[model samples]
Target: MLATVARPSPESDPFSPPGIALEASALMGLRHLARRGTGATTRGRSGLPGGLVTRRRGRGTEPDDVRPWAEGDDVRHIDRNATARTGTLHVRTHHEERDRAVVLLADFRPSMLFGTRRALRSVAAAEALVLLGWRIAGDGGRVGLCVAGAEPLALPPRGAGRGMAALCQGLARGHAGALAAPLHDDPPLSPILEQARALLPAGGHLVLASALDSPGDDFSERLAALAERISVSLILVSDAFERIAPPGLYPYATPDGRRGTARISGRARPAPEDRLAACARLGLACLRLDTETGPEGFAPLMERLDAVL
Candidate 1:
């Protein structure tokens, strides 16, 4: 029987960001292990082919690969087969198989920092990156990360314990560095989108964590274009309270770094649902993580999604 998926609701949702969760250093470690998806779609109902299901190497370690021993290499894990194949001892390097590849596009615009709840959208992005990397790495799948800040950075996918550490560290660093820059500006998505398209291999999945507040509308169009090349998952982070805030006299700041004031006398209009619907029409899996919820709230949703992908 098919399992039912729960519909999203204000009361039922759990994906929220705490005020402070992921520190900068941890993000740097994550960056090293990050890689782009191959843009490959998942298989249909037929399931994986024969011989693909192999035993796992062990906890927190990947399978092995034999290579010729270098001068200063560790001799403890030398393989006998390679010693026989060649006339000398060869080091056995255990490299895990990457069954699935995930690319995280973390967006850290200024708008993401505007939240009314316990945490900002930026916190949600960081948490998602860390949790996703840990879970994916634990499963022996290759994980990669991409940052769409005022500056762009891409971490290639890797399948080793060392690689995972590097990925985490990189993401942590990116998060810290991103905070120092101005968030509002029109960035050309063509180069980054092209890079994303080229990096994602076939059957790979792409996860974009952003607030969708770009002014030029270019990023959204580029995202839609990328979806055609890969299995795209859109994680839109927002604060429910801010999304529905009532209009009143409030202090405000303009995007150009100026203080301003505006009179909002009534309720703000709800964002058009059609924008999200169009994303669905493009075959993108759209998920919203409201900042008002709580940190670690989206872990269950991600766990459930890990299976479906």
Candidate 2:
């Protein structure tokens, strides 16, 4: 069962940082940065289905080559200017765009509500969705969003301008819902992933953003199976406090006005390490983003995604 909590206070709290929230308008600032990559979507091409790292390029189309007419060639391809100049039949080749279907899977669970920096983990995930989600839409690729948590929601893929608008609005709606959602037990991600799969085609890509706080034991196995059909990318959202907290006793308050004390030390948690290791072993394109990370951090990641785009 899911309980409903009131909106978090704007004041500072030990577990919940002050002024940490999601704003759809603020995500547009990411647009200028990752201009190259188109979210998580696979280009139509040939490669190993088991998570192939491939950059799909137009087939024999670049440089507008003028080649001698071959047997069974289409008449529409004939280059009249070249044919007249060379006194022989020639064909003109043109470049074409590769199409991809992009979708983002966002995890907004109990753990995502905590942050010791600029914003909550859920907010960061929302930002990532806006960043790549818009890029995909701008590139003429269909964009879809699936929010996973106590109240899961799926927005089917839509193309171009309207698709981009829906994605942004959906982020705002989903983030607000996550804020009010109670701390239900961490749910298995398999069901949400299965739902996302149904929305995409064979070569589609699924971009997942999460803190990996409570991914089930079969998470890695499930990813391996999914790789056999579609491309996958991961965005690891985290906070500096999660890695090492300054030594001190911090006062915290819950949304229900309950108060408590949390002792903090500099020891790091092992969960992030294990999750990162699994991603590495699977050869997934993974990017780490902390609450303090700025747009400059996305340059390299954008380049890689751009190639895949």
Candidate 3:
């Protein structure tokens, strides 16, 4: 039997940025949108083929990665970064998800801060993560989080516990930090994938949410390499202005108080299309999510999404 998903009301649009910043409550509320159509997307739709799942060791934590410390845990393997950030004792534990762990990577770079719809692209990314994370956790799977930007934050996979709570807190913190960060060249996604590689086990899933403004020249090569080890899903977060900008100069100011004017025209959009084409070539699962449609529209799209699992 198919399930019908509830629609979020505009008056209480959870994706809306509160006080020009994303509220943690809004992000957590996205979990309700995950109840239906999260698991078993498109029958016979395993992201990475069985033969392509590889075993490799990369820099960063291992699959038996970060988790909340318990009475019997060995304190020496504690993840200082995660522990310090979450203000909770965390220890590295070796474990694997029986049904494949999911690590979500969100791009919080300056580019994602721009939006012309319900909320900033970054906030939408956070919503997408929470929805998917809860769905995965609900299915008795572990979920992890990774933020890509000038400074990246990675949380090891956690089941339905404090670890999951920590992951949400991490997302809120990471987004807030990015919103206040100074303008600079956003880092490439390749390195972040390497970090993800280190986090997952032999067969895991990687979900990336980004605007694709600066994927770096080596993105394809790195993506192809990582695809060999993990099932990869790409969410191209965009805005209406990026696709077809209205003919006018729109004034804008970044979070850091930098003012600028954007000259919107009917020029063809290339970056996103190019990136999508590349992912398509690898037979990767790619989904385009526009900030204009907001979570209200995209959450249902996720139900029918065949490739992202």
Candidate 3: tens digits of C-alpha lDDT, residues 1-309:
000111235565322335236666666777777766544432224332221222232223345457787897666777898899999998765432234677889888777776666667877777777776776666566788888865689998887746567778888888777765666776787888888778887667888888777778898888887887678888888776677766887676544344567676665457677767778787678878877676677777655442346
Clashes of each: 50, 0, 1
Q: How much is the lDDT of residue 4 in candidate 1? A: 11
lDDT of 2 by residue, 149-206 (tens): 7678898888766776777777767767776655567888887888988888656788
| Per-model TM against the reference | 0.64, 0.76, 0.71
What's the C-alpha lDDT at position 280 in model 3?
A: 73
Per residue, candidate 1 scores C-alpha lDDT tens digits across 1-309 of 000112234675222223534465544443323322211211221122111123344221453567788787666777788799899988776644434677767765455555556666777777666666655665556667777665577877665566567666666566555554544453544455566555666667777776666524566677667777777777767666546767676665432345555676654433535546666777887767776665346665554444455
Error of 2 at 156 (Å): 2.3
Name the better of 1 and 2 by TM-score. Answer: 2
Model 3, residue 254: displacement in angstroms? 2.8
Superior by lDDT: candidate 1 or candidate 2? 2
| True lDDT of residue 282, candidate 3 | 75
Candidate RMSDs in order: 12.9, 5.8, 14.4
lDDT of 2 at 62: 40
Tell me how candidate 1 scores on lDDT: 0.57
| Order of candidate numbers by TM-score, starting with the best | 2, 3, 1
> What local lDDT does model 3 show for residue 88?
99
Considering lDDT, where higher is better, how would the candidates rank from best to worst?
A: 3, 2, 1
Point out where model 2 deviates above 4 Å. Answer: 1-19, 28-30, 33-65, 70-85, 92-98, 246-251, 262-274, 295-300
The list of candidate 1 runs beyond 4 A from truth reads: 1-99, 186-190, 252-258, 265-274
Specify the highest-lDDT model's number. 3
Model 3 off-target regions past 4 Å? Answer: 1-20, 37-99, 265-274, 305-308
